[model samples]
Target: MKIWGEIMGKADDVMDICLLAGQIMLTYGAETYRVEETLERMAKSASFSNIHCFATTTGIFLSFEEKKEKEDLMQMVRVDDRLQDLGKVTDVNQVSRQFVAGDITIEEAHEKLTAIAKAPMQYPLWLIHIAAGIAGGGFSYLFGGGWFDLIPAFIAAVVSSIVVVEFERHLKVRFAAEFTAAFAGGTTAILLVLIGIGSNLDQIIIGSLMPLVPGVPLTNAVRDLMSGDLLAGVSRGAEALLTSLSIASGIALTISVFL
Candidate 1:
């Protein structure tokens, strides 16, 4: 009885992990035809061989092609326990698209991805604070203000953004460290302009926080979709836009308050 229950539990876990792999594949912009392949590869990496029970790479594609039947294709046992160890994939649009494309069910894939994403990672507080401050100082310096003023402004921006990041972390209680760290990049940019240290506004703003700008992700995201890598494109683009806007908002608010 104990062994039977254990197997059933393991089976459920495998299914969850397998679906998560599909979600990540989609988020990373893998093609519908390729998502299953990615999922299989990731599963194997986690040391589970039971995932073969799920459909084959070819079979998954065929199922998607056969969407009219509404048949569930998640029943291959060849994957065995291989499906029990998938991690999160941070590409939302790709995941959505692939699920809609019938490569995987939205509910299963999305749920597993969300679950895995909640796992923790290192959160760098001081570095993020310094980055934001540096962003501010760089912006002010570019504008032609004296180093004295620029230094203060830089310090202010860094300090304020750090507080904001910390407060946000406290309230949200998610990846506080990471959230603040990434957010600090934008805040630093905002702080520079508010302090009014530089000459060419455009150049100063642009130069100050270029490091924080998610340019590659934004450009690639759009380009990927336009170039037919829809899954990957959407994922990166959304992330870029959000990050850009965040930086702008952070700085704008500080400047407005100072002015």
Candidate 2:
């Protein structure tokens, strides 16, 4: 009975670790297939023969076969928080591989994941704002905006970034934040043109829109579809579509009012 109890406890611990790892990957914008693969790898690493995992955009389900028990263990985890943090995803993948290689124990892997989850931004806040401005400026120039147009595009991008960040912090909704950013970008571009600081209003607006594009989600959606996760693919595609519409709607509203 004592040995049986120990085995059961270890089984439970392994389940928790696998579930938590899956949760982290799903929450950090990993594709459904990648999440499932990671879970399978973790279970295989622990020498479990019967393991099944199903992951969607919003949740994950896991089942493990018990060694000495009659009933199988099952767990479902909900994933709500999502951000475009590919760095964290890469970090998690490395950790997962290391765990599978037997370089770390389950407890150590859990600790590393917890630290990664709580990790701070690699770049400072100001640096991100600067990068956004530079990207906007570069795109504006590439889109045929004259050298003078870069200045206004840069200013517009910085303003849009600030508005989006502030709104997202307060509202916790991606749509609201994106819409607000687009409106601010459009309005700023218009103001720059009115003040004679910008040479081309169209170029400025187009350039500023670069920062608001949902490139990652759109790409991930296509990848998911190719990998045979139809549900997650459709859901993610819809999300990307809605985000694009929100941006367009905001820009259109601003243009109607000002231009």
Candidate 3:
């Protein structure tokens, strides 16, 4: 009876680890197919059979049977508040592969996964802001803006990025944050051009807005569609579309008021 108990306990542990792994991946914007594949691989490595996994934009479901006891275990995890943090997804994938390859035990894998979930952002906030500015400046030049437009674009983008981050932190609503950021970017571009700091208002505003685009979500939506996960694809595509509309509405409002 004690040995049987130990086996059951081990099975439960394996299930918990698998759920945690799937949760981390999904919460950090991993594709549904990748999350399901990782769950299956982890469960199989634990000597489970009849494994099944289903993942969506907001949840994950997994079931497997323990070979030792011939019993089934199932788990469902609700994932909310997704963000584009491919670094975390990559870390979880590395841990999953190591566990499957026997380089790490289930407990070790769980520990690593937990650590990753708790890890801070890879780049500091100030550094990210600076990078956003550089991207805006570069995009402005690429889009035919002269050197005089670069500094204004850079400043506008940096301010927009900061406003988005601050608003999102407080409001927890991305749509509102994005809208405010767009408005702020437009206003900044206009002010800079009026002050003789920028040569082209259009280029400055366009470059500033680039930082707020939902590029990752749109790309992931397309990838999911191509992979035949129709439900997830549609859900993500809709989300991307809504975000794009938010950006466009914000910019339009700004243009109407200022220009």
Candidate 4:
């Protein structure tokens, strides 16, 4: 009985490690296949057999058996509040590879994963906002806006990004935040154009709205579809569609009111 208890305790730890790794990957925009592969690899490295992993956009299911006793353990992890953070995905992948290569023990892997889970964003929020502004200005130029439009586009993009971030932080509603950001961006562009600060309202609004586009989610959805993860693909695609609609609706509302 004591031996079985010890085995179960070890199995529980391994299960926790796998689940945490999978959760981090899913939350940070990893493909479902990648998450499953990583989970299986980690379990195998820990000497667990009969590994079964199934991952979707919203959850992960994992099971494995101990090689000695053939006892099985299964666990499911529910993932919510997903966002695009390829940096975290890369970090988790590196750790998984290291563990599989026998460079780290399961306890060490768990420690590292815990630290990563608690780590803050790779870039500061202010820097992200600044980058959004720069992207907005560059996109405006690319979209045929004149040199004079750059400042307006930059300002609008910065404001929109701030609004979205702040709104989401407080409300925890993604669609509403995105819609508000788009509307704010469009309105800012129009006002800037009216005040002669921008040459082209359309270009400024287009550029500023680029910051809120679901580019990563949409790309990931297509990639998931190509990878044969139909469930994850369809769900992510739907999410992208809704986000796009929210942004479009906000912009349309702004246009109706101002233009």
Candidate 3, 1-259: lDDT as tens digits: 9998888888888888889989988887888888989999999998899999999999999999988678888889898887778999999999999999999987798899889989999999999889999999989988989999999999999988999999999999999999999899888988899889989888898889888988878887898899999998999999888888888888899889987
Q: Model 2's lDDT to the true fold? A: 0.87
Clashing pairs in 2: none
Best by TM-score: 4
Expressed as tens digits, the lDDT of each residue in 1-259 for candidate 4 is: 9999998998898899889999999999888988999999988988889999999999999999999998999999999788778898898999999989999887998999999999999999999999999999999999999999899999999989999999999989999999999999999999988988988888999889988989888888999899999999999999999999999999999999998
Ranking by TM-score: 4, 3, 2, 1
**Given candidate 3, what's the lDDT at residue 170?**
99
- Candidates sorted by lDDT, descending order? 4, 3, 2, 1
Please give the distance, in angstroms, between residue 88's alpha carbon in candidate 3 and its true position after superposition: 1.3
Model 1 C-alpha RMSD vs. true structure (Å) is 11.3
- After superposition of all CA atoms, the RMSD between model 4 and the true structure is 1.0
**Residue lDDT tens for model 1, 1-259:** 7865554454455455555555444433334434555555444433345343222312232111112222233443221111111223344344544544557653565474675555443336687667766776676666665555455545555655565556555765322332343344334444454566433444444444543555445655665667565655564566566665666665565456543
The models' CA-based lDDT, in order, is 0.47, 0.87, 0.89, 0.92
Error of 1 at 7 (Å): 8.4
Return the TM-score for each candidate structure: 0.43, 0.95, 0.96, 0.97
Alpha-carbon lDDT of model 3: 0.89
* Best-fitting candidate, scored by lDDT: 4
State the lDDT of candidate 2 residue by residue for 19-132, as single tens digits. Answer: 887887777778989999998888878777688999988899998876556457788989887776778888889989999999999889889988888898677778888889
Give me the displacement of residue 136 in model 2, in angstroms.
Answer: 0.9
Point out where model 2 deviates above 4 Å. none
